[model samples]
Target: MNNELTFVSWNVNGLRACVTKGFLDHFHSYDADFFCLQEIKLQEGQIELDLGPEYKLFWNYAQKKGYSGTAIFTKHEPISVHYGIEDNEEPEGRIITLEYESFFLITVYTPNSKRDLSRLDYRLEWEQRFASYVTELKSKKAVIICGDLNVAHLDIDVKNAKSNIGNSGFTAEERACMSALQKQGFVDSFRHLYPELEDRFTWWSFMAKVRERNIGWRIDYFLVSEQLQNHIIEATIEDHVMGSDHCPVTLKLAIDVS
Candidate 1:
């Protein structure tokens, strides 16, 4: 039985591209039990990643080439695995669920709210359905969700809260959806550990100096069922490890993995 489980999640923007930008270097250095990724932007046989035989690979690719996608590299063999949140079955490769002895691990690349809010309605629908799906699984076993969630739920979660008001990631609707998830006995692992901390963010704009100046939004997350709260060793943002517009977030859990 394993005494601790370490998970790392990142929105790589594009996995194939990230390979040239220190992804492999950082990936090897972290050596997490489960390393989750979003926006792979590739399909089966499109690219080869040798994460070694020790790690089992799971990939979900978008119907449209070079679009949204997600993947997970896990060292421990899971009992079973699934793609998408049964009901959502999103065309854009989004969710990957791995069922383990102690918990269910899901990684998602949530749909973005277009600049013009054109996809906001669809995004809201997904939020509700996704939340419902995970909550349902939590009723049976602990659920650990990690990935680019695409919504910054609170004022403190965004660097420029006032300026970003009504913006896609900061909109009231998206925030409310996130609130509903938390209200249902799920915990935002990072915020649960570091409430009142400020300026800590996961995603940054590519606009000049935005990331350098640390002006960003905490859109990515690692949320776990409330019952796993005490098992958490720590939840953190690996902002210093760079490659994608968003940094990696890690969660360490003191749990059995037998």
Candidate 2:
């Protein structure tokens, strides 16, 4: 039997809005074993998605209405599910973790620093806490983390790298945080496979039709523990299939959770 497992991660922007724009069509086409989503932008009871009975759904809703949120639909039931990082209260509902017998899967929507860099300090602090949380979990089992990390770790990740250096996603501080995380025994699946590839982005600006020009950033990612590096089968950016500003990123692994 094929032990390969397919995992799809997308920042839908708004799940309700994306659904009207053929989200369901693309969702079915992917047919992934695990479909993780970020920035769902809805509260509980606001939207009910019929992803079919084959997939079990888990959601982490924000305290604020129509704000940050995350969800995961998996074919295999998890041993346990966790919301947020550790015991801290996550008002924005940015994280969801599923624990299996072999591995732990986490999907997170990392906070954006904003255009004016007003929230940069808070975002940096959150990064440290997030790294700590995942590192602690890594001690127990292998980890697969996928999400819209809201930062372009390297110049190769952004189209206008020089001009956007001080910007929210490309700031030195944010890039350093990503580098630190990777140093802590994590490998960026896509970069590990194709380090020289460029102009391939997961997010784009809706204004000025920049996506047509391919002016975008690779903010979404799938990061696995260093131990799972050898099991990496494929990492792809589904840039053509999109209903939101961000497209889906997929990771194929040789190991099967079931």
**Candidate 2 runs further than 4 Å off:** none
Q: Report the C-alpha lDDT of model 2 over 202-247, residue by residue, as the tens digit.
A: 9999989799999999999999999899999999999998799999
Error of 2 at 191 (Å): 0.5
CA-lDDT, candidates in order: 0.91, 0.94
C-alpha positional error of residue 127 in candidate 1 after TM-score superposition, expressed in Å:
1.2
Candidate 1 residue-wise lDDT, 1-258, digit = tens: 348888999999888889999999999998999999999999999888888889989999899999999999999999998899884577898999999888999999888898899999999998888988998999999999999999999899999899999998888998998899999988999999999999999999999999999999999999999999988899999999888999999999999876
**Top model number, lDDT:** 2
Q: What clash pairs does model 2 have? A: none
- Indicate the residue-level lDDT of 10 in model 1: 92
